[model samples]
Target: MILCFALGIANMFHLHWIILFSVVCLICAFIILFIEIPLLLRVCPTSPAFDGFIRRFETNYMRAAIYFAMSAIQWISIAAKRTSLIAAAVMLLIASLFYALAGVRGQGFVGSKTLGGQGVAQMIV
Candidate 1:
């Protein structure tokens, strides 16, 4: 969607192998997303609060992973190595921002505990 267009902007050439790799990555990502949905639906609740928190954290983590992988695909498309690296770095930053915001609001995984009570959780690469 939007991500595909953003990444396509950086794609300078239509290398068959790179395009193939990107397609494979995207397929794998979609598979992962599909598999996680059922598991998320089945997480049982021993405690109401803890259960709610876990569900939210899981959602955020999945979103971050998906976005990061999409950005990595874009990174693979750029022709200039240095420029690609920089673009990848920026993509990572944007992904981290999304992760932190989602994690903080979810109140799990380093929220209000680590990061100096800032309630922000960082991406795990």
Candidate 2:
């Protein structure tokens, strides 16, 4: 990611890195929406009250909506051309926040105690 930013800066005269950045963001959005959602469905059971597909859809709607919005915004930025850089930056920040939230969703807060503690377990946040 730092490499992407460095190259983007180095090529600022043409603003070509905006294309690369948008493409990467689009790829990430696909993985989050298509790949991760299906994988999560396999891990988590559907609600008994609803049909399987409907339950899966209901359970995952918020995550799907967020990723879908991120993807739409990135694609729209690509089309905007003149303000693509600013758009990309905003989208990237949103993507980073959501990704980190998903990654840490079930983990205890940073610096929290570990199981079977004999001593403090180091945590890096």
By TM-score, the best candidate is 1
For candidate 1, write residues 66-103 as lDDT tens digits. 55765565555454333333354355549657776877
Q: Cα RMSD (Å) between model 2 and the true structure?
A: 14.5
Off by over 4 Å in 2: 1-17, 23-58, 82-125
After best superposition, candidate 2 residue 89: deviation in angstroms?
17
Tens-digit lDDT track for model 2 on 1-125?
Answer: 33324434433455455555555554454444432334333334545442343334322334445545554555555554654445445655565566557555753322213321223323311
Clashes of 1: 0
Question: CA lDDT of each candidate?
Answer: 0.46, 0.44
Global lDDT for candidate 2? 0.44
**Which regions of candidate 1 are displaced past 4 Å?**
1-15, 39-59, 80-96, 107-125
Worst 10 residues of 2 by lDDT: 109-118
Clashes of 2: 0
Clashing pairs in 2: none
